[model samples]
Target: MKNNLTSQQMGKIKNLFADRVRFNKVERLVYSHDMGMMPEQVRALIQCTPDAIVQPISTQEVINIIKIAQEEKIPIVPRGAGSAGFGGSVPAKAGIVIDFVRMNKIIDIDKEDMTATVESGVVWQNLEGELSKRGLTLRTYPSSSDSTVGGWVAQGGNGYGGYEYGDFRQNIVSVDVVLPTGELKSFSGSEIDKVYSLCGITGLM
Candidate 1:
């Protein structure tokens, strides 16, 4: 039979994996704080410290990391740029911090179809820069230069120009997500055309 981790066992697990995370003092400090100042959000998450922070470059790697976390019953927090005014990026249980920053890649741009496929970590500016050369744009972009495409999409972010260009919710053609159930799912493509399918969030983004 397998043994459940006691408090001390969990602490040891945290300490053991601390060395695996690559953030230096400054990086750690930046991540230690977020844009939010609300009591619960600010006090509840001050970067309690993660067991191990790993950067996964592909969907397969993300799946593997989540599987390990679930097998151990450790709390997992998935983060991209770790920027959220609501402190949503903060780790509540402080186990594995899977940073997808390194996964930045624009996989495909089908000009004929007017579709672009990008990795979760790809930055919106990068896409804008590339697409602009072709006189195309995502029609919407987050204001922050450091804002990431993945983070933007995850939060359903919008910009001031949305008044004319449209909100972030309407600009998104599709979305891919990994639910807490340990499954990788995509809600775009033909599945989006269905009136009954709501895996991808519906109504106001």
Candidate 2:
């Protein structure tokens, strides 16, 4: 995978992200394995390390990274906290692992409308704390409260309180995504169905 990226491509990413892009073999190794308990046989056969890892601090940065990925024809795996326990964060084709940890800001908490706009990286526990201060609470949460909001959604809706208030899908108001073509778009209500059905092939949510 490293061999697929040209020096110019590497330079472009380095120039844009500075210290946030990592290529060192040791550091990159961490992205290979996920939270799943992989069987020894399967683990022995797969060398899953990604080519590089990029941590974007904002939506604009994510868009920029996607644009670069498009130009370079590289696979971009969107990751948040890497707690999904599934291999969703592990790059299948060995390209860029776009870690969203740095983008974990709670953008807006609209108590009036009973909704919140958060960066994809915002953790459930953090958001819960924020809402609790205002006497509000999350409708549902996964057993792992440290999981990112976006991660839960990508893992096919979320959490344990579905019996009481419905699942993640039922509560979602809208989603802001960065498309593969580097276009930024927002989908709400029924529009989000298309994105969900595509399984994120169209964009990063």
How many pairs in model 2 have backbone atoms within 3 A of each other, for residues 3 or more apart or on separate chains, i.e. clashes?
Answer: 0
What stretches of model 2 exceed 4 Å from their correct place?
1-3, 40-47, 197-199
Writing each residue's lDDT as its tens digit, candidate 1 over 132-177 gives: 8888877677777576766766666568579887756566677666
TM-score winner among the candidates? 2
Q: Which residue pairs in candidate 1 have backbone atoms (N, alpha carbon, C) closer than 3 angstroms, thus clashing?
A: none
TM-score of 2: 0.92
Q: Which 10-residue window of candidate 2 scores lowest in summed lDDT?
A: 193-202
Residue-by-residue lDDT tens digits, candidate 2, 65-182:
8888887788888887787666778767778888888888998899899998898889999999999999999888888889888776677664688898887878888888888888
**Once superposed on the true structure, which residue ranges of model 1 sit more than 4 Å away at CA?**
1-30, 37-47, 189-205
User: What's every prediction's RMSD, in angstroms?
Assistant: 6.4, 2.0
Instruction: Show the lowest summed lDDT stretch of 10 residues, model 1.
Output: 196-205
Candidate 1 TM-score, C-alpha based:
0.73
Per-model lDDT: 0.61, 0.82
